[model samples]
Structures are given as structure tokens and as C-alpha cells.
Target: MVYTLEVPNTYGYVVLGAGVGSVICNIVLGGPVMKARKQLDVPLPNLYATPGVHKNADEFNRIQRSHQNYMEMLDSYIAMTLLGGLQHPIACAVGTVFYYIGAILYQKGYIDKSLDVDLARYKKGGALKWIGFFTSMYSTCALAYTMITAK
Candidate 1:
């Protein structure tokens, strides 16, 4: 008997999902940190930013919140992936793409949060929030089903 390493073809989507998702996540997190440094006028490393920094800056807080939410979602995605147990190649891959798209939208929408006078332009109608949430749910279901049915 010989054992060969062969990943299911459908897993390609899963791989792409992780790769692109990571890049998008980094952007979400990194952009805010940079903006925070500039806004707070904190020197290198002193960006040890506390919420107090946003006392008068609404936009800064929005950016900070977006980063925090991304971290939380990342944890959820990891758990779902683990529960999915590397099975259901097709479902896993498809779910991953949708998940990434949802996260991107979610981050964009949250970052856009503002109290600017031009409220109309700044307002995001919760599109990203719902998209990210539903997709995250769908992926969870897909993973659970696959794990439950696996032999």
C-alpha cells in the first residue's frame, strides 16, 4: 500500500479564499493603525493607542472599530474551518469565497462610518454587515453538514 498526497480539486477555492482573505484583512487592520498614528500624533510605537484617543475624533473611532470587528470575524472563520474538518471540498471552497467577499464589504462599510455633514454620501445601508454575516453563517452550516456526514 502506498499513500500519496493529493488535495481534492475543489480545495482550490478554499486556498484562494484564505490567500485573498488574508490580504484584505491585513488592509483593514493596517489602514486604521496608520490613520490612528497620524490622527493621535503619537510617535513611533507610542501609538499604544487607547480608546481615549478618539475622544473628539469620530472618524478615528470608526477606523478602530472596523479593525476590532475584523479580528473577531477572523476568529469565527477559523473555528468554522476547523469544525468543517477539511472535508466537503466543494462546499468549503465556495463558502470561503463568499466569506471573503462578505468580510471585504463589512470592513469597507464600517470604515465608512462617519458623522460628516455629508451624511448621505457617508451612510452605508448595512449592506456589508448583512452580507458578511449571512455568508459567515452559510459557511458554518456547510462545514457542520460536511463534518456530520463524513465517515
Candidate 2:
């Protein structure tokens, strides 16, 4: 006799898991990675010397701390969703795909200086910037929501 594996209706759990995962990963791994990249490009001391440097630094540190909290929160959230069990592999896989795609776009030139306002206005009212902006936003939201809601 031939046997086949059965799949469970875990879409809701998957979505929530992925959503929580994305948020946690983005906060923990993604934020530091992006900050490191920014440090390479602009350097931290230079960042410290900017007009609102103190305020900015405070905000940045707050965000970093928040990411750490988010990571811990994810553990609890996942456990709650999974009920002390592992998440479905398919949901994890799909979440990973979305996470990487967003990461790549963000790491590329999508959020660079050329896309900033003065240049955007100079180059005819920011069509490309807006497109990129919307794309990033949509991708991020979809990925987060899908991860959170997947069962």
C-alpha cells in the first residue's frame, strides 16, 4: 500500500507566525544590518554630528532596543500560535522568500539619496521614487501580513 502525507489547515497560524517572524527578523537582524550599512556609507561619527544628532541617536537607539524586544516577543507569539509545536514548513518557506526579497530591495538603491525629495522634485516630481516607495511598502506589508495570517 502507498501512503501519502496529510496537510493541516494551518493557514491562520502560518500567517501570524510569518508576520511575527518578519517583524522580529526585520527588527533584530534587518535593523542592525541596515544600520551597519549606513555606518559604512556615512559613518557613525558623522551621523553624530548632524543637526539633530542627539535626537536622532536617541531615536536610533530606541529602535534598536525595540528590535530586541520584538525578537523576544516573537518567541512567545510563535509558541502561542504553534501551541508548543513547530510551524509548518511551507509557511516558513514562503515567509523566508518574502523576507529576502524585501531585504534585497532595501539593501539596493531603493532608499538612497537619489530618491530623496530635492532630487525627486528636480527630476520631475518623484515618479520613480514613489514607485519604489510604494513597491517597498506593499511588499513589506504583504510579507508581514501573510506571515502573520498563514495557517
Candidate 3:
């Protein structure tokens, strides 16, 4: 006997959420990375880091930091969606939306050069930055539990 997983129609909302999130991430990351590549004269592939001191190293760091901040949370969001999405699409959708919102918060702070102020200033908006993390984490945990104990 083969067991098949059921993907509910509601799951589409989660997909939508993921789509929105991806676009936000790509758009947010693109500007800095692209500008950094050009400003550093390092080509697109080498945008990850500034390599050595360039005239625009400080500016490049802003772009690089925003990209890094987005990626830092991306994996966890993807994992939670994949692991718990089928079991709880509504939760996943909500989680995904907030996760994207959280990323947006981080990106806004990064591009504004807010992080440069200091660690305390960087975390000034504590609730906003962490809501996504908490929402996804809780929903994913709940979904995982449901999956394991299903009758």
C-alpha cells in the first residue's frame, strides 16, 4: 500500500504568501547587490563581498548587510513552510505573511543605515522584527505535532 499526501486548496494561499515573500526578498536584495557590483567594479557574481577597500566600501556594506539579513531568515521560513504547510495551510499562510513582513522590517532598517548606529539601536524595534520569527516557529511546531500524532 502506498500513502499519498493530500494538499488542500487552502495551501494555495501559502504558495501565494511564499510568492509575495520571494518577490520582496529579491527586490530588496537586488538594488544593493546590483549597485554594489557596479560601484565596486567587481562584476555581478562577486557582489557577495566588497573584497578589499573601494571608494564605496561603506555604501557597499549597506547593500551587503541588507542582503545578508534577508537570507539569514529565509532558510527557516522555507523549512517551516515545507515541513508544516500541508498539515496546516492557514497557519502556514499567516506565518509566511508575517515572515515576509519581518524581512521587510529588517530591510527597511538596513537600507536606512539603522544597523550602523549600534546593537541597541538596531534592535530598537524588537517586536516588529521578531514577530515573523515567532509566528512561523509556533505554527510550524504545532503542525509538526499534528502530523506526528494523526490517527
Candidate 4:
């Protein structure tokens, strides 16, 4: 009824990488949003541009929202990846990849000006987003269960 407390070195590294990668992705995504805000003349402290009031407001809003959406999920993703990596590194790693890929695709689709459907383009990456989120959730739960049951 004993358990080893050590996490595999590779697993630890993978977890660290996932966390760092998420931050880096967020930072990179933000650059475009910042540039769009400046170029489109979106002022600071305004969460969003007024529809039809600001020139190209929709475009700038979309760009900003894409980055904001990623930020919204970043904290949870990092936490799940770290906790889950303790028990299931491979699963967490895969989940991280899925999430990032999905996030990027979602961002691209959301920011595309050609799409006239407003937020509908997010559907393009919605499936992967769910899959990745669930995967991480499962792994994190497994880690919790293991810790509680361990002797």
C-alpha cells in the first residue's frame, strides 16, 4: 500500500513546457490584438469599440476578443496541465497541444474579416477545444484520486 512520490523527469519537463508554451502563445496572440488596437485607433480602457460608431470597430473588436478568449482559458489550462502531469503527463501533453492548436484556429477564424457571421467562425475549433478541456480535466481528476488513495 505504498506509492512512489517522484514524478518522472520527462513528465515534469513536459508539464513545465506546457505551462510555458501556453504563456508564450498568449503573449504572441496579444501582439496582433495590440497592433490592431493601435492601428484601428481603439482607445485604452475601453473593453470594446462601439458597434458602427468606430471605423472598423467590428474588425478590431474581433481581434481583441480572440486574444481575450485565449486569456480567459489560459489559467485553467495551465493548472490542469500541471496537476494532471503529475499522474498523466502524456495525456496532459496531448491535451495541451490540442488546446493550443484549437485556440489558434479559433483565433484565426474569429479574426477573419471575410466571414460575415460574426462569432460563428469559432465553431471551426470548438470540437478540439472541448476535447482538450475534457482531456485535461480527466487527467487532473485522476491525479487527485491517486493522491487521495495513495498510502
Instruction: Give lDDT per model, in order.
Output: 0.55, 0.41, 0.65, 0.78
RMSD of each: 5.5, 11.3, 3.5, 2.5
TM-score of 4: 0.83
Give the range where candidate 1 is weakest over 10 consecutive residues by summed lDDT: 117-126
lDDT, candidate 1, at 147: 53
Q: What tens-digit string does per-residue lDDT give for candidate 4 at 35-79?
A: 887898888888788987789888888888887888887788788
> Number of the top candidate by TM-score?
4
Off by over 4 Å in 4: 1-4, 116-119, 123-126
**How far off is residue 11 in model 1, in Å?**
0.6
For all candidates, what are the clash counts?
0, 14, 0, 0
- TM for every model, in the order presented, reads 0.59, 0.31, 0.72, 0.83
* Candidate 1 residue runs with Cα over 4 Å from true position: 1-7, 42-55, 82-91, 113-151
Error of 2 at 25 (Å): 4.8
- TM-score, cand. 3: 0.72
Candidate 3 — which pairs collide?
none
- List where candidate 2 sits over 4 angstroms from the true fold: 1-7, 11-29, 36-56, 84-151
**For candidate 1, lDDT tens digit of each residue in 1-151?**
4323345666665655556665666685667668776876644654244456645355555555556655666766655643342455556555565555555555556666443524422254434344444554666687566556656
